[model samples]
Structures are given as structure tokens and as C-alpha cells.
Target: MSTTSDPAALSQETEQRPGAKTRVGGLNQHQMQEEDDIETVDYKMVTFSLAGKDYGIDILKIKEIAKFSSFTYVPNAPPFVSGVYNLRGDIISIIDLRVMFNLPAERKPEGSAEDGLILRLDELMIGVVVDSIDKVVGIVSSRIQPPHPIFGDVNIQYISGVVEKDGRLYIILDVDRIFAKGKSTTEEAESLSAVVAPETSAASDNIDELKQQTIPGLDGQSSGKNEEELDLEFIREGLGTFRGFYPDGIADSWLHRRYSEWRAERKKQGLDVQLTGEDDADNFMRTFFSPYSNRFLGEDYVEAVKAVLPEEVSKNISVWNPGCGKGYETYSLATVLRMRYPGHILKIWAGDNDLLSISTAPNLVFGADAVPTLYEPYLVEAKNGYSFSSEIKDAILFEYHDVTHTSTVPDIDIIVARDLMSFLHPKQQASVFNEFSQKTSTGALLIVGQNEHVPESQDWQHVGTSVVNAYRRL
Candidate 1:
């Protein structure tokens, strides 16, 4: 009539029972119970090693596993704090578990990356560095034994439990308790949340305050030129920090115009004009992209692009399309080019930094209704859905490439890089522009984002209409 939570006690009970091994359907009671336990694997842990000992965290808490180095060092942070890393675009603080637990760690060579697990703790994302990452281990929840002081080098409070599987003993870590703010025994432990989450918030607030301040001139009114310039500078910095959008010579004119609009809109809403966070920065620059960015180009957009096409061109038209995400924009452009010059041999070198997107782009398929009418001529019905014709598919070479690197694409007649320059560093933007100038001859067309503008130079002429921001090398 009595029940126990201990697995050892239950096993002992099974041993004491009479006919415990009596077979039913060629399997004993204990053997069947073992199979049932195996089938009920509800808990999954991403197992890893720290200082030669196996440790695990709940799989649900893991966002991803990554290996990267050169984290941007924070000015004042705890010794356990590795630094901040830009995961794609969102910045996350990195913590070294070995350092936090006061354990010996393998010293990686300078600039060498360490294994890391990005954890999604509530709304905050943090990266934890470890010695090595192992495979995922799934076991029954009831098999986990209570944490003991002698089980792991980590504090008992941080250790959730210990589980043994295949001769490997894993120390389960309660990340919630480890990262919980104001609930730790020591001041250093309590500051983990403060260092990771609140510090970023405070930095964002400081940026907002710096942008909101208006310096007064001799006449008592705010200094229009200096204040506006200061606000613009902050906006540029925020765009780069929050979203990696660098508005330098490439998007300077559009940035100025957008700043005026953002200021007026914020004033009308009685809110500060400064970008507060990622969401605020996104809202400020929402109208900066072209009409159809990630999707197929619309009918009007195709016509507008076609209108800007040069009247006379060579028989072999070579085009370079960077940031060709999922090949939607590339396919759209290819369709337009094919229609614009049917007799010309079209070749498009499409490049994107996203490997998944670039790999799947060549095999992109869509329903007939999903694409614009302009793409109807190139549609070929397949088992799954309609895909581009062989001619259109063969015309493009989708490669995983970053535009900041040296491009092997031959001399280009046209470059379609919309909404790409603003996301790169200023120096990178300058380098890409220089490449464009170098690879292109006179009358080569250059199409950028709607809000972006090519810098004024004798080598390039502004030939864009109100619909498209384009230029021509002169």
C-alpha cells in the first residue's frame, strides 16, 4: 500500500516480490516495466561537457548551438562574463560556465571560438560557453535522482538532479536558478541578470536620452543645426547597433529625409524621436525598402524596373543580384530581364549570405496564384507546384556569398542590390561601391533600395525615376 519515489527502492521491491520474473507474453514484469519506462521518455536534455565533466540543460531552454569567437568585450563586467555576441542581429551576452563555477577551463588560442549554447531564458537570450557539446540525452523524468553535494562541482542549488544513462553520469543544471536575479546567495550571482538584460536596457535608455537632449543657442531656442545633426548621428548609431543598418554615404539622403519624417511623426504622437530599441528602430525605417522585397515583384514594380532599362544593350546581358533571398527577388528580376530583352542571353549571378536560402533558391516552387502575372510566361507546372521554366532557372546561379568579400562574378552590366548596403558596415559599403565602380563600365545600371542613394561622383550619374533608386556609370 506504500509507494516510494526512489528507483532503487522500487527495484528492491521488485526483487522481493514472489514470481517477479514470471513471464507474460515471453517477457517478465520487470522487463516490461523497463520497456514502459523507455517509452515514456518525457524529459530531454542537451548534454555538454564542462571541465571534463558531463553537464546538461533542458532542451526546451536551448535556442541554438553555435561556435563563434571575438565577442565584443563589455567595459565593466564580471570575470565570468565572456562578452556580448551579435547573434545574427540581436546582441546576446555570453557567460563562461567554467569561470562561473570556479572550475579549470581549457585555454583556447587567441581568436579561437569556443562551443556555446544560446539559451532562451524567458524573454532574454544568453549564450553560455562550455568545453564541448555532446548529443541530446532523453530519459524518463522519474529516473532523475535528487541533487547531492558530492554529485557535481557546481553548487547544489544550481544542480537540478543527476541521471545515469549508458555509463555516463550527467549533472542537470537548473539554468533558471543560476540566472535568477536577486535569488542567489552571493552578490556576483545576483548580478547575472543585471549584467545581461538590464545593462542592455540601460544602454538603450542612455542612447534615447542623448538623442532627446537639445542644446540651447544664444537666442534661447534649440540650436537647429547642431541639435538636428546630433539626433541624426544617434539615429545612425542606433540603427547600426539595434538592427545593423549603417546609413553612411549609401543612404545619407534618404536617412536625412526619413529623420525629418520620424521627428515630425514622433512630435505628433508626443513621443521622443530617438529610437528606443529594435522595435523602434524597425518602425523608424519601415518605409526604407522597395515595394516587393522578399516576395515576387509586383506588376507595377516590374513595369517600373523595365522602364529604367537601357534602350540599347549587348546580346549577352550579365546581371549581379546580391541579397537574393530565397531567389524571389532574383527570379523576379530574371523574369523582367527576359521580357525586356527576349533575344539576349541572360545570365544572373545571384548571391546571398544565407546558406539555406541560397541552397533552396534554385528549387523554389510556388502556386500559380502566388506569383504576379509578369512571371506567367516562365511558370512550369510540377508535381508540388509551379516552378520557373528551365530557361529561367538555368539563367541564374544562386551561390552563398557575402557581398563584403571579393566577388568572382565577371564584369556586370547591371547590379540589383536593394536594401543591402544599409546593413553592412560603412567601410564595407564603401568597398562594395568601389567594386561596383571597378567592375562596371559606362552605362552599367545600378539599382539600390528605395530610400538609399548612390553618392555623387563623376563616374556615376543619377538615372533613377521616382519609382526606382538607380544610377548609371558614366
Candidate 2:
């Protein structure tokens, strides 16, 4: 999917010429000339139908397409939400695009459907329902044009492009934008207002007391220090408050993005502020660290990891697996390498800030079903559940290391930090990015989160499809 723009871009493109007559005809002379000017590229698209209209999404973005299943409804959720469901013990929210776009409601609320496209975006998994999947067709880039004005009924900004094939138009929908906007439907505003109305007074009183207790220099009334210094202190106190509220998975990037606007409002009013309200914190936390990514051992993602591997497997290689939650990814990588290149020496140094999580890495035990089917050969039945082979255990050296600070990690070849950088602020992200480049060998592979793109200006060159964020060190 491409980067998204606001509604103005849609309006500007849809502006009709003075004598322009909207018709379903072939391309014009100007469009044909433009097509000839550029090299024609083909993108493999998984075409699906909704409300009897055809739409397509990039096949690479898809993790696994499954049949429709029953979901548990969430009360007070947005109108477009179908509800949540437990997919193999992982709870995922389902979104009904039919209702989301005000199309004719054709899908049944409960029952199996033809297909559900499962998308893993930023550690969150969402299943989108469609009537039936057409064929995986190749659409040429030159044939793709800007969104047509007829799509104004649905939100136009979400349409990335339109392609004409076999005298029919296929609208390319940007999944990222659809999920971002659909999560906050119009009904959500009313729901949020009602929930906040009763708590406003009590929250005000608590904020007043908290400011007096937490904000430094507020009681002293000192004037010698600069305002910028005081503002910095205020931010520090705010972050501390947030830490107290959330003990695990707290990222400064998420904190600022979630509350920066509110902080600006407080500063404009010339009033000292405490931390953000409980509601905002709850919402942001839920969005960032969703429960759906429990195993982090999906087959499709593991295959993508395998595809980027260098042709010549080194006899001895070092790898750094940062943010190795529950060591799921750590074990998966070990299994892949062991099977792919037998007798190859592997030295993986996996670490996570979460102490309890990193501590369990040495045990090499996993739930009976936690391990993927392909890696089952490496598992031995244990009293608890299953334990990986000793060979698998010997390949890793798990440690407790925080990437935020200047800490020495083992000289490595590959670094797998998926969905880890998204939690960090831009400053921290850059710090980590530079550190990864310095720590890795020349031409080492960097497999980041699906949507995490390494800038071209940096010392990394993007390899393979732009849809996949795999990079090779320069």
C-alpha cells in the first residue's frame, strides 16, 4: 500500500474539466501517451468483492486468508465493528467494511463466509470480510489511474488507485487507512462523550491534586529558571505518571503521539498540567499492545523471514533478536536455520527489557501448541508440555539488554526487530537504527516489522518489493 493523503487530494483529482463528460470508455490519447512514457510494472493483487463491487489489496500485505467465523460482539463499539473473536486462542477484532462504507449490507452477522483476509499491521491482527475472492490477477502500473469521482460515495481518501482490466474497473483499497479510520466511527464520538460526562468533575479534582503533588517547582513559585526548562520538567513528570499507570510496554513515541495535542492546549491556556486522563491512556495502550499477537509465530511471516536469507549460509553467524517476546520469534528463527542449512553453526543473542520473559528463554519449553507445525520435529514431549531439542537450546544466548541506552551487543549478521521500533519515538528509533547499522556486518540482512521502512538516505538499501520492508546493509 502507498502513503495516504487527506480529503483535499481526492477533491483536487476529481475536479472535472469544463467540457468533461463522465463516461465508461477507453483511455484517452493523453493517458495512453503517459502510459507509453513509463515502464509497465505488474502488481499481483488479490481481488475480492464487497456489495457486489470488485476491490483489491496487495497480496503481500495478506498473512493468511481464512473462512469467515463467528465473533463475539463488543458493546458500545463503533457501528461498523462486527465484534471480536478467538482465533486459535488469540482474540482479534473483526471489521465489517460493508457497514463501514455505508454500502448495502449483504453479509450475515454470524456464519461462515467465502473468505476473510487476515492482515497483521503493527502487531495488531484484523480480519476483513468479503463476499467472495476472485482470482489473483496481475494489474499493470501504467493501467492504474487515480481514484474516479464515482467512488465519492465511500471515503475517497482510502482509495490508493484504480485499475482497468477486461473492461472492468478494480478499486485498490488501502487497508491501513481503512483500519485507521474505521476504528473511530461516528458512533464512537457519542459513546466517548457519554462515558466521559459523568467522570469529568471527579477527574478535574484528581488532576488538581496530582499537579500539586507531582509538578516540581509549582509550589516554590521560582522565576529565575527559563520557561523551556520548566516545560521540560513538566514533560518528565508526565512521563513518570504514565509509567506508574502502565508498568509494561510503555513507549515515549506512543505517549507523545497520543497526548501532544492535549499538552499544546494546556500550554496555550497558560495552565500547568498533570498526566493525560485515564481514558486517553487506556485507549492508546490497547491500540499499541493488542492481545492478538500472543504467539508471534505465524507461518507467512516466518516464510518472509526465510525468503530474505542470503544464498550462501555462513557456517558461523551471529544474530540479535531484540524485543523477543516470550521467545516465540527466537525459537522460530532457530528452527528455520537448523532445517534449511544442516550442520551450520548458529549463534543468536536474543534480549528483551521484560525480565520475566527473557528469563524463560533458557528453559526451551513451550506450550504444546505454541510451536508451529513445521518445527514440531524439534520438540520433545515434556511433563509440562513440550521442550525443544538440546541442539536448538544451544544455538541461543539469551540476555537482558535495553536497546535504548548505549549497551554493547554481540557483533551480529542478522537483526530481527519486528514491531519493536513502532513503540519508540522517532529519536529513539533513529538511535536504534544507527546502532543496528554499526553493529551489523556489511551486507547483513535487516528484517524489520512489516510496515517499518528504513529510509533510503540511511546506510540501508531496500531490497525486493517496496511492500515488504527488507533491507540489505550498504
Candidate 3:
């Protein structure tokens, strides 16, 4: 992409003869307009309890209040994963809070609908199996305080504080900590630590083994929960179910069309098929993605970087760009290295697996709006396909990649993928995270968009939120 226009060139283009009138009219157009004065509104959260104790979580954190039900076990997952049972094709995990909270083993329910409650965080769907669920109550910041040391029954560090409403006290949970306890987190972390450095399950003994139970007939009995007690029929969690809430069909219609189009575009792109999202995601990437590609790495730096990068990067440090579209990110990254390392050597690979984007990249030209406001300062010389001298730049190459296609990544220096997580389908977000983990070697940096997250379970230490973020690979 052309990406950026030289500022000096722009100034030269607009220059006027000798002494031209610098002012247009009496007042500066920019100064005359006042800044937009829009107020930011904060929403209040409601508090509630699970079991007998009072607990408060963001009311928004909840999608719906579902009761408990039997969950099908996901093979080789951690004990915490519980298992993947179908909530109408939405694979939900039954987080055995009984084990988490130090409670006794939980009795499984025999049914399709829930007996306890279902809580979701993005694409990760997990059914929190609780003794019982209380009603929803509202709370504000002023009505909350730090948890009293006395209520130390549930030993969790992520707790934010306590809340009050009408003589009621609630212990708000730190979901960041609670969900961080998942198997995916620790395993991914360990694997990344190994991959970034050098190192990298279907779990058995699901609830059936964890609880030591046998499959009983429909007319089975448990200590407290009951099978065949509730209806086995289910609430179908179809793809567009989330669009149901928007009235007049405006939001739903837009969402439906977007997702449908994306679904179709995915087939056309022929990108690594394993990395899936809403059908619309592929469409979004195919179109909007290429535009952003320039900003990701840009044409100037990509070719220059690769030319000068050090040998360490090429031989060992692989470069990863998560949202690489049209190879602008790839080319710009390579350019940065070449400009720095004229003679040094390293192993670096720039990757993105969008075939159309990749195939179309080298030929595309960028325009001004596709550019970044600033440029990376550290760069020097470049000559051919890629010749570099900077100990920093000699270490990079390019590859076409799709994170969801692999569980492990090659050894690398930095992984840059920006603004992608927010648009990932809510259903595929978490597992797709594994692909990110699989690609790095220890001490490598994993860059992400501002709003994205590494599972609390993964050991992705926060880096920064500049144009994007950088996480220590381990």
C-alpha cells in the first residue's frame, strides 16, 4: 500500500508563490469550532448471591440467569474445564466451583437446561454450578468497599471490593481471577514459555470420573439434584440468537447480514479454514483488513526493517503479525529489519494466512489515509531483497499464517496482531487464543489490540497499549 505521503511533499504541493496570504478570512477555521462536548455515562452494576453468601459481579457480566444441568465432558481438558456440554451447539463448560471454592463434590443434574447458573466471558461459555442462585440486586461505586478480612471464606485475590444496597452487604467477585483458573490458561502459558524459549490435552476423568459416577438411567437419583425432574428440552443457542434483543429488527438485520456475508466470504478467501469466526469476520478482513494492513507495519518500514535486521531474528527470532492483511505488515516489518542490519543475520518470518490478502499485497498501492501518524525512528540502510546490518533488524522473514490453524508457533521475537480480538466471533475467541500461544518462544513479545485479552489462564504479562500491546511471550 502507498500507506503514507511525505509531509514535506504535502507542504511543497500546497506552497504558494513568494508572499501569499497565509490567512483565509478573519478567524482560523480550526479555532472557531469548539471541541465536541459529549458527556460520558457510566452504568451502575447490580449485586446478587450464589448459595447463601452475598456476592456481587457486574450485572452486565451476565448474559442470562440459567439453572444447572449435566454437562458433556470435553476430553483431555483440565479438571477445571469440567467438560463441554451442548447448550444447543454452544459448547458450555461446567466450572466445578465446588472444587474452586473448597466445597464438596457437586452432584450433576440430568437435563438439557440449567439447574444452577450460566456465566459467560466473551466466547468462553461456562456454567457455574452453584448450590443455588439468588435474585439480582443493584449497586453503585459509592455503596461498595474493600472486602472485610473476616469474610475470608472464599480465598480469592481478584476480588475488587464489597458492595451495599439497602442494609445488604455483598462480596463482589474478581472474575478475572475466577476464570483465570481454567486449564487453558496454565497450559497455554507453559506451552508459550516453552515455544518462545524452546518448549511447548484431551483430558480424561471428566465429571464422570472426577465425581466417580456411573451413567444411570433417566430415572436416576442424586443427593440433592434430581434427573428427570426438569424438562430435557433446550433453549437453542443459534448463531443469531444474540440479535433477538434489538427491536425493529434494525440491529438484528444488520448483524444477520454482516455475519451471513462474512460466512460466504470465508469460503472465497480460502484462508486457513481451521481458524473460524462469524461468516462476516472473513468478509470484514477481506475488505477492511487490507486498509489497516498499512498501519500495522506500513510499506516503508516493512521492506526497510527486513533489509537490516540482525541474524538472531532470522535464525531464531520469528516475527508474527496477528492481523496481517495484504502483507503490508509483513513487508513493512521486513523493511524495518533490512534498513537496520545491512550485513548481520537472523531468522525472522512475517505471517498472515489470508491467501487473497497475501496474494494481492505485493501489487497493491497505499494512499495517504492508510498511513500511521508517526514512524519508527530506528532505521538506517537497505539495498536488495533484504540486506541488513543493525543487530536489531537482521533477524526477520515472512510467512502466511492463521493462528487457529496451529497449536504452536515457531520461535520468534515479536508477534504483532492488532484490533482483531474485538471482532472475533464470541464463540471461537478463547480456543483461537491457543494459536497465539503456540506461535511464540519464551521471552518473545505477543502484541495485541487495545481491547483484546490473553486468557487470565495464560501467562501473558501485559506489555503496552500504544497502537497495540506487547505481552512477554512466556
Q: Please state every model's RMSD to the true fold in angstroms.
A: 23.6, 23.2, 30.3
lDDT of 1 by residue, 1-474 (tens): 012224477667757654655535445766778878667666788999987899999887888889969999998898889999999999999999987875668889999989999988889899999999998888888989998756535767789999998899999999988887654446654554455355445545654664465333323565677777778878988999999998766677778888999999999999987899999999988988888888999998888999899998866788999999899999999999999999898999999998988888999988888897878878999889999999999999999999989898876889998999888886566557777876676778999998888765666788898888789877
| Alpha-carbon local distance difference test for all models | 0.83, 0.66, 0.49
Q: Write the per-residue lDDT of candidate 3 for residues 383-411, one digit (tens) a residue.
A: 32222224433343344666555634443
**Model 2 lDDT tens row, 1-474:** 221213356455547522242352344555546757763444767788887788988765666677767678899998778888677888888887775765555545556553677777767799877777787767676677898646743556679899878777789988776776455655555564565453444445654675566456554655643354355455545443553332112243444454555556666977554446555444434434422254745676567667777787445677888888678778888888787678877888888888988888778566877666887888888778898787888898787877777755655678877667765544465557767865764567887655455643346777744323578876
Candidate 1 Cα misplacement greater than 4 A, ranges: 1-228
Better by lDDT, candidate 3 or 2: 2
Alpha-carbon TM-score of each model against the true structure: 0.52, 0.41, 0.32
Q: Name the top TM-score candidate.
A: 1
User: What is the RMSD of candidate 3?
Assistant: 30.3
From the highest lDDT down, the ranking of the candidates is 1, 2, 3
The 10-residue segment of model 1 with minimum total lDDT is: 1-10
- Residue 457, candidate 2: C-alpha displacement in angstroms: 3.3
Candidate 2 Cα outliers beyond 4 Å, as residue runs: 1-282, 285-296, 425-427, 464-468
